[model samples]
Target: QKEVEQDPGPLSVPEGAIVSLNCTYSNSAFQYFMWYRQYSRKGPELLMYTYSSGNKEDGRFTAQVDKSSKYISLFIRDSQPSDSATYLCAMSEASWGKLQFGAGTQVVVTP
Candidate 1:
């Protein structure tokens, strides 16, 4: 299996829908889970970070990690057109920095 796998989705939905983006990894050594939001041609901005398996919430964004299953998810509540962007899931084994990222999922929130 690859270190990390994610579908590069062009998932389209209405503005008010709840959106979910996910990724799975093969490495058990990964200790950090992160979610990032990226606009076209721009670098991804970190959205959420979790040290281990659990849930972290910030505003309309929620990140969930399941270390036992090597699965991670990002949930966006009350989606808006502004939320339309590529969502990336990343992980790291380092205690300080450097992350390994998925290919990213593209989302379109139509008004």
Candidate 2:
């Protein structure tokens, strides 16, 4: 089984809503973390990156990591239809290709 477990949510929300996403991992060796957003038929683009147990915010997006609990989360404020995408949580013990990925959660923000 994969080291990470995440709900593959087809989470639907209205415009200007807040979008919440999370993931859990079995590996404590995971020191690096990232969140990727993938649009339909497109590659995932880096959305957030955090290395420690804390929260990081960039604009309307926030990423939180709790290493003690082996959990991580992402929040998107003021959701928009353009924000509709698949969110994949990624991690690595070292860096680069060692990344482990979670089953992406599908999100839809309706107008």
Candidate 3:
């Protein structure tokens, strides 16, 4: 089984709408979950991160993890056109260099 899996969606949303993204993992050893946003032809930048199981919210972004279910999610509220980008879910098993990544989901926020 793949360690991590995410729907690579070209998810389209209107401006000011809420966007939801999710990922799942089969490995119970994963302790760190992270979400990253990348613009076309650019490097990914970290958006949110959670340690183990819990929910974290920052501004319009919320990151949630369910260790028992091996699932994670990211929610963006009041999304803007500038938020259009590729979102990637990644996890690590207590090793910084050994992160498992999912296929990035592309988001387009239309004005």
Candidate 4:
């Protein structure tokens, strides 16, 4: 299996829907969990970062990590067309920097 796996989704939903994106990783050595949002042709922007397992929330986004299951998730609340983008899950050993990423999930929020 690949080190990380995520459905490269073109998951389409109407405005105001809640969106959930997830990934699974095979490496237990990964110490940092992260989510990134990327627009077409743009570098990803960091969405969230968590160490080990637990939950972290910010504005419209929430990130969850389950180390026992080797899984992680990102939830978007009150989704909007402006939120259309690719969501990427990443993990790394260093808390200060760099990440290994999933292929990314593409999302479209329509009016």
What local distance difference test score does each model get? 0.92, 0.94, 0.94, 0.93
How do the residues 27-99 of candidate 4 rate in per-residue lDDT, one tens digit apiece?
A: 8888899899999999999999899999999999999999999999999999999999999999987787578
Error of 1 at 15 (Å): 0.7
For candidate 3, which ten residues in a row score worst on lDDT?
Answer: 91-100
Q: For model 3, state the Cα shift of residue 15 in Å.
A: 0.7
**Reference-based TM-score, model 4:** 0.95
lDDT of 4 at 108: 99
TM for every model, in the order presented, reads 0.95, 0.96, 0.96, 0.95
**What's the C-alpha lDDT at position 40 in model 2?**
88
Give residue 109's lDDT in candidate 3 (0 to 100). 100
lDDT of 1 at 77: 95
- What range of 10 consecutive residues in model 4 has the weakest lDDT sum? 92-101
Score residue 85 of candidate 1 by CA lDDT.
95
RMSD of each predicted structure? 1.0, 1.0, 0.9, 1.1
Model 3 C-alpha lDDT versus the unseen true structure: 0.94
Please write out the lDDT profile of model 2 over residues 72-106, one tens digit for every residue.
99999999899999999999998664889999999
Q: Which of candidates 1 and 4 reaches a greater TM-score?
A: 1
Clashes of each: 0, 0, 0, 0
lDDT of 3 by residue, 1-111 (tens): 678899898999999999999999998999999999999999999999889999999999999999999999999999999999999999999857588999989999999
